[model samples]
Target: MTQTASMSQNGARGLVRGGALDVLRFVAALFIVLYHVAERAPVSLFALHPALSRGYLGTDFFLMLSGYVLARTYGERVLSGGVGTGEFLKRRMLRIWPAHLVMLVVFVAFVLGTAAIGLAPQNPQWFQWSQLLPQVFLVQAWFVPGISGWNMPTWTLSALIVCYAGFPAAWRLTAKVRSPWTTLAVGVAIFLAVDYAALAATGIPGHQLPLRFGLVRGIPLFVLGMLVARMPTTIPSRLADGLAIAAGLGVFALQALGRFDHASLALLSLLIYAAGASGAKGSAWASLAGRLSFSLFLTNQLVAVVWFGAQRAAAARFGFDATMLWLTWALALPACVAGAWLFERLVDTPLQAWIKRWSRREAAVPAPASEPIAA
Candidate 1:
């Protein structure tokens, strides 16, 4: 079958939902949680498994995946004017904003509660009140100082919002290039140029760009995702399967070797493309995990904050042994995962339903008739 026929036969199944990518998303979220947990734990998981140290790469994967998924879902509609820019952004904002606001409030309460009880955080600078406004407004990642304050992971969300704002233009640009190969080449070139420029300007790779300028790090990868989404899936399923396996192994190998080359990022992109092209309908468990991935990403930091804080307080008061600390550290991972599941069901799901209902009600209400103009 032709690429178009394959996609149609599958009902664009991989792009729409239920695919290996969902499982990958959950795994990425898990690694992100592991990354943060390792940061705060007395015994670092990174020490035992060096590859765990590279978990920040999960954010890069997420940004790229967001581009691919959004393009697949809305690119055509957006380009053809079936979805207005305002409406698209509004929906995207609504999807993320409620959970973010709730998490922000939770962080604020945690900070205030700890302060009231005279329990100071180990890193007080991370909870600066001065940075709260920018975070609240979701512009913390846009050249703002202290962008890493409050909920540090939310920096990705801030960067993602900026990407979403520019998505229509990015999609149009991607589509305007008639040849998929040319589009792919240009996207790769732009990403490499930016990556190297970042390396030259700041000793950090573009993917590791500072949180304060996360938009710079996010846009190129996101556009790369859009470009990948627009490419024809002409490779056979068996070849796509081989590509997926190879790319997945390459990513792990690079991480294990402590190599932070652009190849890992390229491998991640390839892994996503292969998974999509293979057209495997994902299992229900994978779908559920995928649904919880956003919550997992957003809430893990908060979980770390609370878990570590309480561990510190308890240890100081009781003079707990290393064994107790280590045990609690192990438990932190599950706590983070469970916290994410609860937050999604109790807070995000309900708020999203309410927002949809409110939107429908607003749409149903007819506009008031214009008053007659004075002569």
Candidate 2:
């Protein structure tokens, strides 16, 4: 890294450590990979233990994380009315789309290769062209997921898109509310209550609303994150670190025990916002980890899933207890770190430049100081 970028990161090191929240983000992504990983194994490592059920909560942490960033980055923008819905979406799309397009193509290619080699399972049900098209669109979740298009974690991207779509409307409603705290409270209560009530009415078995492209399930959590960011005073560093640690344990422990009840999740969400409010002083690793976290979250699962497939094949071919699978996951950590680094460099770093250009084009840019005319 260049000295400037390094220093920028160093400055951020204190500011962005997600504390436990950041750790939870990376861990959440890894846990999702593990859930899939265990599923591909002869026996689930998680099933042997009761705590493995927490894999479903990755999206919950995501909601918390989203809330934090929204408040940190854009909370005030809502009232000031500078960032319009379209511009906000444009930035979001730029961040997500480039990699998403590549990832989508890669999956499609994998499916095709599997089919060509006769390795594709004859589930007739799992493989279909109709589903592939929409999966490419990242809109497949709007309909049912066919086995052929079964990218389980990609649903996060789809659901986030829904949340982004709803944010403008939600902002209007929340902004009109008299108090920021009241806005946050009503939003959280409405989502949880309405979601749970609807789940009860529909006889849905679990607390998570339908796992696909779901706005209703996510918006409240996003709002809570923003509320944390909007707090009048920055959280003290020492306290932030403590909450950061607590957030990680909270998510991990809940997941370990196979619990994500409304109460547990409510607590979890509070910790997430708190960590964000705390900001930089939390912990060293957390700040570093959180810095590249979004990149890590988006890319790690694909690597893990791809590695999982390769390991499954290699294991089947070589007759192993998925020993290679272990090796792949082991290797994947560094690979994921490296990928995140590159993504931060190529995709994320460009955000500032993009924002500058966007600002220049929309708002007036300060003129350069006139050069002294040399005689």
Candidate 3:
């Protein structure tokens, strides 16, 4: 095959670009936000009442996508000595932490400001200093359990950091496996075992493993995504595109039914595979939205709280009915979108550029002059 053909088939690599996966990222992030709307709403909307009830699964999709994209973008470089582990980690940290820290500070200020004004947060437990350590260090999901303390959605970032730390080793090990399919199968089995174990132990998956065991919840699927990345993307484009459609439908159907956890994951895997294999270039808007998705996901809790706070302050007279819930959701959704866009442009974009420039300067800096006496 020609080089261009190969590149198209394999999909673009790196965080800034991918093969239609950015669109998937946008969709997945939106799904989670809508899910949160249903959960936090005084009453759920008729339109969102069905599939969104299980929308927390969107985070599961994000975890897998992260693994897949990282492996595709950096795995070969790390394995081939093109990128050092230190640099790889530095880049990952630069990608996430600057934006994350900004949001963390904002979240903290919101809590403190509200408390000072005699308006204790509705979820005061998350505002405690106990969560500060984990949140600051991005280890909440690993060290702490149940909730992500300051920002509820950020636990995923904590778990992702863990995965990023381990990915070099994991990628190298999986590369040696004779059959990537077998590795994926084993991963799926392990995931099922853990899921069932959680189900049996708790009698319900309700806020059990996913909320508390971020490491356990994340690692297997992450490994599965890496394994998937190893497969040749030369599958016929038409077939892959068709499979993508089918997988999307399957995801919606399973979500609506709200049963069979593994099936949902399987469909997600198929979606990723199809997206990678179909040779579709992501649209500009999709790419921009995907880039903003991190901001969107991380800042949502704060925005929602701010919306509710405003409502309370205004004495808007909310009620336990669809109208009030929809109204709050409507206001909150736009705030999240605008906040995400602004955070991406003002905070994340500039900070990332500065970090990259700093890294380059550090690399360019001359080591201390060798001591003449030693020479």
Candidate 3 stretches greater than 4 Å from native: 1-19, 45-50, 145-147, 201-210, 315-325, 367-375
Model 2 lowest lDDT segment of ten: 1-10
Clashes of 2: 7
Report the Cα lDDT for residue 69, model 2.
62
Q: Tens digits of per-residue lDDT for model 1 on 1-375?
A: 001212432245335354677788998988888887886667677778777777768999999988887877787678788777777888899889888999999989988988898888888888888899988988888889763688888888899898888888878877787887898899889998998899999988888898888888988988888888876666777888899999999998888787766788889999988887775655678777888898998888888888887888899999979899888888998999899999989998898889989989987777657853211
On TM-score, the leading prediction is 1
Clashes of each: 1, 7, 0
Model 3 scores worst on lDDT over the 10 consecutive residues at: 1-10
Candidate 3, position 278, lDDT: 75
Better of 1 and 2 by TM-score: 1
* Over 4 Å off, model 2: 1-22, 121-127, 143-150, 205-207, 231-235, 255-260, 279-288, 321-375
Give the C-alpha lDDT of model 2. Answer: 0.60
Candidate 3 versus the native: TM-score? 0.88
- The better-scoring model by TM-score among 1 and 3 is 1
- Residue 375, model 1, lDDT: 14
For residues 305-345, write the lDDT of model 2, one tens digit per residue. 56666666776788765565566656656666677677667
